[model samples]
Target: MKVSLIFPKLPETSTFIGTVKEAEKYSKDKIEFYGFPPMGILYLATYLREKNFDVSILDQFARGYSVERTLKWIKQENPDVLGFSTITTAGTGIISAEISRRVKEEINPNIKILFGNYHATFNDRRILEKYPFVDACIRGEGEKTLLEIAEKVEKDQNFEEIKGLTYRDNGRIVRNDDRPRIENMDTLPFPDRNLLGNVEYKNTVEGLELSVGKFTSAASSRGCAFQCSFCSSSMFWGKWRPRSPENIIDELSILEDQGFNNLLWVDDNFTISKKRLLKLSDLIRKEKFDFNWMAEGRVTQSSKELLNAMKQMGCKILSFGVESGSQRLLEWYNKKITLNQVYDAVKNSKKVGIDMILANFIVGAPIETREEIIETLNFSLKLDIDFPQFHILGIIPGNWIWDQMVKEKKINPDDCWEVGTAVLPIPLSEIMERIRQTHIKFMKRPSYISRQIAKTLKSRYRQKAVLQNIKNIERWDIWNSWKPFWG
Candidate 1:
């Protein structure tokens, strides 16, 4: 069966721009223009193609592919099925529904559509009720279930018999029992890089080289181990399942041969297993592949020995999630690491000559006070890191905190899309203003200002290029373009 998977583009928001800018500023290279690739779609495409299903991936974000283009492709390819993947409160479903509606009206009325991922897993009934055109929603990991669904469509068989699926039957929604999660990580085929074509995947920064040399994307090992109450990885992958170091090295070697120089490991907790990490580092060193990779690690994970080994394995940067400095808030959020670990990690990373970017001070959580917010700001200023990102906390769905807020009557259960107001007692405007002030203060820090000046002096040519690129794009006022919730 021929299948097409679609990943939607993000709406313009200051928080998104601010996040991108922070990522760009920290890198040693000049920033290039590229949008985030839909890795999930690529993963699905890879899985389907491995099963001998004719599959294609469409990343509207990077391709600048419009609805008209999508319709044209649908009409041209005439795929038997369409699949969409989305995150909780990401608004992908709304966009997908719009496109599906248009496709039915203009292209093909009988084409089957399926939705999957975190959002659909949680809100299948609501989605099916809202969009009657949607044929089915696959829950949890979609690799096996999608293949089964494709077979059913190919044979014109009954879809209701498929497990781990939700579909409409006689004006009523029917949900099947959950499917078992895949235990053996090695069973799945490697991602289909062929689907990406010749797309140049560069980040906002230019100097940083990826292993692929052309496109920059990530391949993850395990999901997050810790439950920070605000994250959604737990909802999807359930805790963690660390992939074998050999498997990772093999993938790295393959991509390295494919001209990939810089690889980004997207695991939320890449360093949870010290033994596995050390082994992986040793393997990479032994292989002697000419590739540089970056990954996200916890503050507690950055031991002196581990940092040294990682640096030897071409680890250029270690992005630490120093969520907040205030001990009270950190404990309240169940982030087990202490403030001392944050300092030690930074010191160890620098000692190993690895650059560090501190992901710090996410504001607007429940129980957060103005004084507590100031304490966080003060803590961030004291940290010795190359770059720090300050963002307002986004209360995504399927989080423990979201459930707690619902039970405590802190926020209306139905008003999940609002962004600005704290679900807790604080007023929305006050929360927004506090976040804005914190961001401004961090930007004005002596270290940040000095670094900016040094960057301007050291790389005037690159700086000019960046400034010219920035000038050409429309800049949104920081405060004016902020959205408190997913719109």
Candidate 2:
């Protein structure tokens, strides 16, 4: 049976920016600019293809395929089963349902529609109940579950015994037992990059290429050891499972040969184990492979030794989730790292000569006082890192804040379309203003502007990226983004 997985576009806002052709052009600009491939879909596609099923991927968001074009592609492919990778952010999950409805109404009515990944995993029943079009939701660690599903679909068998499956049975909902997490991650095949088919992915900063190389993302570890309450990762991924150094190097070696030199480790915490990095460094050095990559680090885990090892492993950039500078807020968030540790981590990364250090700070928590908000902004200025990304804390399905908000009746759990607000959400306008003011305070300085201008003069790619921004330079939205905020 033919299987097609689609990563649906973000829901149309304002009728998708005018005429369909203009909208398509606008979408192409949005899609072609940022984000790497949808690795989850790539893994699923690879697994299905290996099982001798004809599987294809339609990354509508990444490729900028409009609703019309997407439906056209769907009609042409006419797969027996259609799966959608949906996320809760920005009503993308709801859009998947809308697309599924179109597919059933306009294209093939008999195709089995499935929703998987973060949103569906948490709201499986809600999705099925609210949208009757979605046939099933394959919950958590989808590789094995999806394989079982493909087999079931091929044979026209019901999803009775499949683990990690939530499907309808004769107009009644039936959710199977949850699937256990995969312990030995090494057994899983590397993500199939060839399926991307000449997308020319690049690592970009404010639409500027960061280093001008082939860029992709990988995850060496799943989940975070420390479940910071505001995070949804631990809830979604279950636990921290690090792949062996051998497995990681094996993937790296393959990635190098595939002509992808620049990479970003999409792991929640790549430096969870210092030993892992030391060993991986040795392996990369032993292999004599030349590849530069970036990864996220926890301040508590970012020892000088670890930073040094990461430098040896060709880590060009290190990002730390320094959510807030206030120790009180840090404790509430369960970051486990102290203000001093944040300092030490940034110090060590710089001392180790890691090219770029990015620190992320969240402003406008529900209980966050005006003083605390300013403290975070000031703290960003104090850091000697390459950049500081300040964002308003967002509420999603699996996060602690979301649950608290739900408990407090601040948001409805069944409201799958909207990102949940914090327990005591700071008003949207106030939060946006605070974030805007933070950017203005950080980036609009005459010194900072002149410094960035000097840096821009040194790189032609950055100059081009800056030129591209001239059209939208009047936008307040630009300042809201980390890279463009400073620029």
Number of colliding residue pairs in each model:
19, 0
Candidate 2 residues lying further than 4 Å off, grouped into runs, are 12-32, 416-418, 422-425, 444-487
TM-score of each: 0.85, 0.88
Q: Give the number of the best model, judged by TM-score.
A: 2
Off by over 4 Å in 1: 12-33, 205-215, 417-487
Q: Which residue pairs come into collision in candidate 2?
A: none
lDDT of 1 by residue, 1-487 (tens): 7999877544443134312332244344433334445667777788888889999877655555567787786788788898878655556666778788887788777788889888788778777988888888998888888999889889988777788899887788899988877777777777866686544454433222222244455655646778887776877777587678888788887887787776677788777878888898888889987666667889888898988888788775568888887888888788898999999998888778674344556766778887776677677777767556565676656777777777887777566532222454366677666665655666667878886566456643335545644653442232333332211
What TM-score does structure 1 among the candidates reach? 0.85
Q: List per-candidate RMSD values in Å.
A: 5.6, 4.4
Residue 66's lDDT within candidate 2 is 75
